[model samples]
Target: MEPLDSPAPRPLAHIPAIPIFDPLEFDRSLPSSQYTLIKTDDLRSMYREIGRVQAYLHNLINRGDDTPSLAIDDSKRAKTAAIERVPPEILSMIFEQAVPPQTDDENPRETHRLAEILLPGQICRLWREAAITTPSLWSSIYLKFSFPKNSVEKMVDIVTTCIARAKGYPLSICLWNQSDTELTQYRPIIAVLLAHSHQWDNVFIKCGGGPRKNPYEELQGAKGCLSMLRRLKVEYDEIEEGGSFDTFLISPKLRIVDLRNYGVQPWHEIGQFPLLPWRQLQQITFVGYIEDALELLRMSPILRVFKVSVVGHSVELYHVHHAFLLELSVESLVDGAASDLFGAFTLPALSSLSYAGEEFPRDAITSFVQRSNIEQSLHTFSLTLHERRDTLLIPSSNIIKCLESMPCLSQLSLHDLSKRYTDTGPFHSGDISSICERLEPRPILPKLKRFSITGPPQMSCVYLALMVKSRWRRAAGGLVWIESVEINHSRPCAHAKSSMTQIPAHIESRESGRALALLRLYRSEGLRVVGSLVDEDECIECIDEQGYGAFDPDEN
Candidate 1:
């Protein structure tokens, strides 16, 4: 790597530093109401005092002991030696926990908290020795390449010293690929870090490169050494060849891998490896897909979560053979029987399921509900229909039915009810209310704490009212509402308004007994009713004017 040109240092001013309020007093008294008023003033003064003390110390350390201007202060020296008594290994562990995350706005290599960690060391010679000996504290380095001409080589040299001092504990380095020119200039340093890939446990590398038409070919260079690494992420300028990331198949220790905007490459060659060593693999996402990605998935036994999508092609899961949990996303489920995705065998441990596609078979939805242990542990269940197909195999009717089947759901998110409006017949809110009312008298979703329905405002309001009445009768807990716009306008805006106005009327004084009983149950069961509206300008204005702005959907 090329050496960075150094700049002239600025002159320092002479000033006596002061100590602010005691940390003990501030921590003890700050939380009271009476003390809150002057909290801001106290904070400002504390900041100024800290800055002054830091500046004074910087000036003192820069000048020699013989300088008359710098006086020796030994009051903090006793405390420093006492702190120094702690072992270097222990000090290193403490520093690792105290280090803050690196960001672009400040000196990336400098740990602003380092001085505080070494404050005990600053007080005496013994503490100083211990603090400097804690090599792990300096090993975690961040190189900011924004001003390459100013900071590159200096940061590298400092980092190298830290690594040498660290002995052998792996180094955690964060390098921000700021410019292509910097990348070319610092290629050797980048190669050094990449060549020692096994040492990297957490790393984020955002570099420049266009998506290759054949994604597997993109992993040709130093990227091979990254196979022993635990976490790997590759992002290219364009995402044409998502398949090329198949080169990542070499990573046997990988736990989390994110390949953005790339197509899934065939793993025919890589698949030949003994057993896919992704025992710790929990999450995997692919933005684009080729037909053979499923074959590779079958080879990976520990995968708990997956997301795969292809624009025009259909994704078929011939068998849901995974022994653990599974999550899938597809463009369309048209014509294909949903059961085909899951073999006769059901997901025994499946806890969360979300599907977004054109349409799903009602039998498949029923089979999914019937085959799984819906009565006890199904935590999250959501299905979204993208387009109006032959007919919704699972309509709002089926959804209400399926929900009735799941008794253990604590949080539920339902979306895309517009699919119920087909060319043959129109679905209505009454049908939804009737279905909800029919739900067995048991405390279905009794543990339900947070609920969200994103669709037309009318449908959401009706569902909310019906759900409240049902929950009130069963004594459910914590109701939170999140409403978002529907993709298609199946119902008119005027109709949505009329339905929302019916909400307050539904809780009328005539049925005040039920309403009061519901309120009482909510209080007793710790239920909170939170409601919101989306796509209704009038609702937002009313909320702001009426002082219920907290529920305004615009905030989301």
Candidate 2:
């Protein structure tokens, strides 16, 4: 059907016209039937002639379409095309980009979607050669040992081919076995990755986090062959009934170990867990009981970075002192429990400390600082206080004393990631006033250069202005310590749907008088300002070095 607004097609002036007898040319004395017969015969001959012309035009169009295609094929076949002249080395570099990147800390649980086709190799013969010859193209392999038989069969072939083509390059092996109760079915695929354990640079393995057969039992063959291993991450729902994941114990080059468990695997029962040469580890992330965390600290004497989640509590109490630990992050899965766990550890070499939980843990922090001998040495501190039904909003009165202890602090971030608390924020208005007074008249956190607050400050904007002015005033007088003041606030949202972000920032609005005044002050001082707000996801700064969230284990 023609569009409603479209014009009716008019005849082209240059095209042949249909032949017919004109009414004016008919003889007045002749019968109408006789005239019609003459006109019909003459029209038949004209139609036949037009058909011949139409056929010729169609033949020309077909020939015109094929000619350029034929020429392009010849040019490529004869190596006259620019693409055909590319050197093998350059082609290999281009092929690498077409391949997916290796797994990283950001996503260790990525899956086996690349099995059906190696994109670079499937394009053409030249591309296939370049991709096959480039060992790095096959180095990053994410495979699932469980499957639909046919696709698994194809994946097996692909893995075998990649292993051969990859040559001697180290492999980043990510294997996930989810629903295969009978492990023997994929023994061939398992054996293929296990054979290359000596060249393992980084490995991520995820198995049944619940009670099930031990997936790592097949990894026994790789025990002594992991000398070249550098990073290893293994996650399970819970430790199997009568099993231990000790296959990676012999790895010497292993500096980073990530053991993520979504289980109540108690400290007493964690003996069957992975036992590594802890002293050799420089960085570690563990999600377990606090007792197990302390044990790890005691074992890893030379450990530089340790991130821990206190998922379970310890029945007995003990203290661990590490002389070489530089960074310590404690994530309390239980409310009002963060500081209690900190009471059991001391790290004199600690430079950065981060704690996220329901309570502020001021007393624990003060004693911990004194016990660890970091009162004057700690340089960076981040705290996150989430409002809970069982917790109090007011931090301890000694909270002021905690900041005074950290004289060398360079960065301080306080995040009040509360969903239900609407009228208040991380500190009371009086606390904010007290803090500003300390910054102006008294001295606290003297070396603090970067101060960031997320959520409403629960104080008038006047206190914030005074605090900034005092710090910058000192800097101008040659004290020169203050750097940046980041103010992030959220307005009470109405008609917000459940699909909206957990915490919404009204970053789009700058209409408040206080906001305008602060912007003017910042501009008048000639400070570099970024007209951007930090992502809410980034406000969880206690997890990764600058962000928070649990590392989700495999759910597929």
Candidate 3:
């Protein structure tokens, strides 16, 4: 059915009635005479054309007003061009001074935080390009990404950009991946980057202390990745479930290899690896091992610094068939089975030696020291007993003998790294005090520069005093002293305190009374102290938690 229209159009809500420009009446009606039409087209075309001419003149007047403003802008730009300009070389020098890249320890974890700080300062486009182009600046690369689940894409982008900027120069790559689950996912990206491993000069990879994957396979697959490698360090903890022993050997061009805390393969296989290629090898550190020294000796010809820490039950003979003109740390358990290990281990060129497990037989330590001394190149020597209590027990008198043996030692460090422990075997008390007594007749380290003693306060005090006296006697130069004393007043058997009773007698000596006063004041306060003394009498201001002491106006 068709709908019927309304009789008249209903007034629309939006429309307003003109009412002939209504003044008083709200709805004024227009007169019929005003509605008459004027036929302008029939009248004249010239008048209409004249109206167009007036509109053109109005636009020209407005454009003329804008011309002066444009001229003023041109004048301002000319003024800006008059300033001085800096050359590219000078700019590069400024950027290099402003942004220095971070180089980390043998392990990559140490430098990770530092790299983040330096990364942001390189925000300027020109500065960033300069930094990235500088091979030396970009040499140390830190690649760590396992943050959010969606970070892999961003990680790949950053790595690709860094690689492009590296421009084929040898790099120090530190890849710290914390997720084993993500490892397989990211393996392809790593393989692509590491395939350019030959571009690495000194690579240090410290995987996160989380589950790890077989990174060695990726490293091996990288074509010529280690060709330019000079030093390599791989430190992974047990937390990285997939970490393996041979991970440290990924780079064949490694000159210095440090394997710490990570799981590794058998010692025989490690020893069997050809040492002939590492002709330039100087240092090898194996902190935790399942094998003996004799087995590792197979790679000793070029070895300079060898450190191995094995448990008491697994002590094995660590002998040196060749003389090395550097440092050596070969130790075994103090049990009877360790005699052969100690006797057979001789370091003719050894300058530094540290024993951690137990004191070897007096005769064996003495013989080892005597042989080491005759070499005449020994410069630094150290002997430490790992476990001690209140008693000053000195298990290896040979330690004292070893001090006397190295007449040429320039630097000495004596340490008792052990904290309070229960007596399990033939134990002695007051070991720290006895150690101090043995160290009293300080071995004349003619070139001694640095000396540190870490243990209880009583022992540390005697040790430091004796060290000072020794230096006084020899008039050594450029001495750097470190005293790390733990203030624990819980143990009543304070032999270090009882033994220092004689200090009053020394204090009474008129020659050193002033120095004794300072020492006494420090002791009474029970404040842990560390600093250096220039002259015995002059108390040079030093730094501590209390802040640095300043020059006094009255004390000229």
Listing every candidate in turn, what is its Cα RMSD in Å to the true structure after a full C-alpha superposition?
A: 22.0, 16.0, 19.9
lDDT on C-alpha atoms for all candidate structures: 0.47, 0.64, 0.48
Give candidate 2's TM-score. 0.65
**Regions of candidate 2 where Cα sits further than 4 Å from its true position:** 1-137, 164-167, 209-212, 236-245, 269-271, 389-391, 395-398, 419-442, 456-465, 473-479, 485-528, 531-556
Residue-by-residue lDDT tens digits, candidate 2, 1-556: 4322234552332355445444445566445597777876777667777767766765665565456333233345654567767888999887666444654333332223464337777867787788779987777788766676656567678788877787887777887778546566677777887888888877887777543444787887898899788888887556554555568888888888887754656645657555677879888898877777777778887889888888655546687878998888888888545666878877888999998877667888888999888887899998777666664545223456788888888888767644323233332243333344345555667677787756442323344444665566545433444777766544432112210323223221211223324434454566433322222222112222312112212120
Measured on C-alpha atoms, candidate 3 has an lDDT of 0.48
lDDT of 1 by residue, 328-353 (tens): 44333334533344323356566766
TM-score of 1: 0.47
Q: Can you list the residue pairs that collide in candidate 1?
A: 77-123, 215-244, 216-244, 242-262, 242-263, 243-263, 243-264, 243-265, 320-343
lDDT-wise, the better of 1 and 3 is 3
Which residue pairs in candidate 2 collide?
Answer: 209-236, 209-237, 209-238, 540-548
**Each prediction's TM-score against the native?**
0.47, 0.65, 0.56
Q: Which one is best on lDDT?
A: 2
Clash number by candidate, in order: 9, 4, 14
- Evaluated at residue 96, the lDDT of candidate 2 is 65
Instruction: Report the candidate with higher TM-score, 1 versus 3.
Output: 3
User: Candidate 3: worst 10 consecutive residues by lDDT?
Assistant: 543-552
The deviation in Å at residue 444 for candidate 1 is 6.1
